[model samples]
Each structure stands twice: as C-alpha cells, then as structure tokens.
Target: MPELVGTDEDDYLTLNYNGFVPLLTKAMQEQQTEIENQQKEIDELKAQLEMIMKMMQSDMSDKTDNKKAENNQKPVKLSMATVK
Candidate 1:
C-alpha cells in the first residue's frame, strides 16, 4: 500500500508535495462539482413540487365552482334509469 506523506506543512517540501497538491486540489474540485449538481437537482424537484401544488389548487377550485353551479340550479325528479 502507498503511504501518506507530505500531508502537513512540516513535510511540505518533500518530493511527495508535488503529487499531493494536485491530488488534493482535484478532490476539492470534484467535491465542489458534486455539490453544484446536487443543488441543481434540489431546485428542479422544488419546481416540480410547486407545479403539482398549483395543479391541485386549480382542481380544487374547479370542483368548488362546479358544486356552486349545481347548488344554484333547480332540482328535478329523475327516474332510476337516468341516475347512471
């Protein structure tokens, strides 16, 4: 197995320093990229949820309006065959 060297400032000038800096930098950049990707995914999910909520609200409003219209209409007696 490879050993961890030049991990501290005390070993900063070791031959491994050149290798360690680039590797650490790459890791940081990868982590940053992952964070950005996750943020975008979260934003998309939030937008989708908002759209669903709006659709549900619109459906509820439509149902309420239909009920109001029915209430305003005069009732009529219907035969059992017409009920379906």
Candidate 2:
C-alpha cells in the first residue's frame, strides 16, 4: 500500500513503511538482549542476598546461645513478707 510520491531530485531516495521493517527488527532484538542481560544480573543479586541472609541467621543464633548460657549462670533471689 506504500506508494512512491516524490517528484524532485532530492526525493529520489525515500524509505517507505516496508523499508523500516529491518530497522525495527534490529531495535527490538537489541532491546530483548538488554532485557535478558538485566534478568541475569537480577538473578545473581538474589543469590547474593540469600547468602547474606544465611550468614546473618547463623550469627544471630550464636548470640542467642551465648545469652542463654549467661542467664543460666546467675542465681535468682526471692523476697517473703509475714502477715498476722
């Protein structure tokens, strides 16, 4: 449906809608590649976050165990009052 509508010498080299298919295809392919690369980076970051969470959990458990041991070593004192 694209018709050539040029008359001047400067309008001899004109691109129609069909001529733009290759350019659009190339642009879409490049964008897809960029999207795939970004997804790989996101996956790597998620793995790193998982490792950090595991390390924090292990450290927290150690601290909790040490606190329990300290509390067990202390003696408890009780107070009593006499009533008539």
Clashing pairs in 1: none
Enumerate residue pairs that collide in model 2: none
Model 1 misplacement above 4 A: 1-18, 75-84
In angstroms, how far off is 7's CA in candidate 1? Answer: 14
Query: Could you give candidate 2's per-residue lDDT for residues 1-84 as a string of tens digits?
Result: 255333457666554767678878999999999999999999999999999999999999999999999999999776565433
All candidates: TM-score:
0.66, 0.70
| Global local distance difference test of model 1 | 0.84
Per-residue lDDT of model 1, residues 1-84, tens digit only: 145443456655335556677788989999999999999999999999999999999999999999999988968779999988
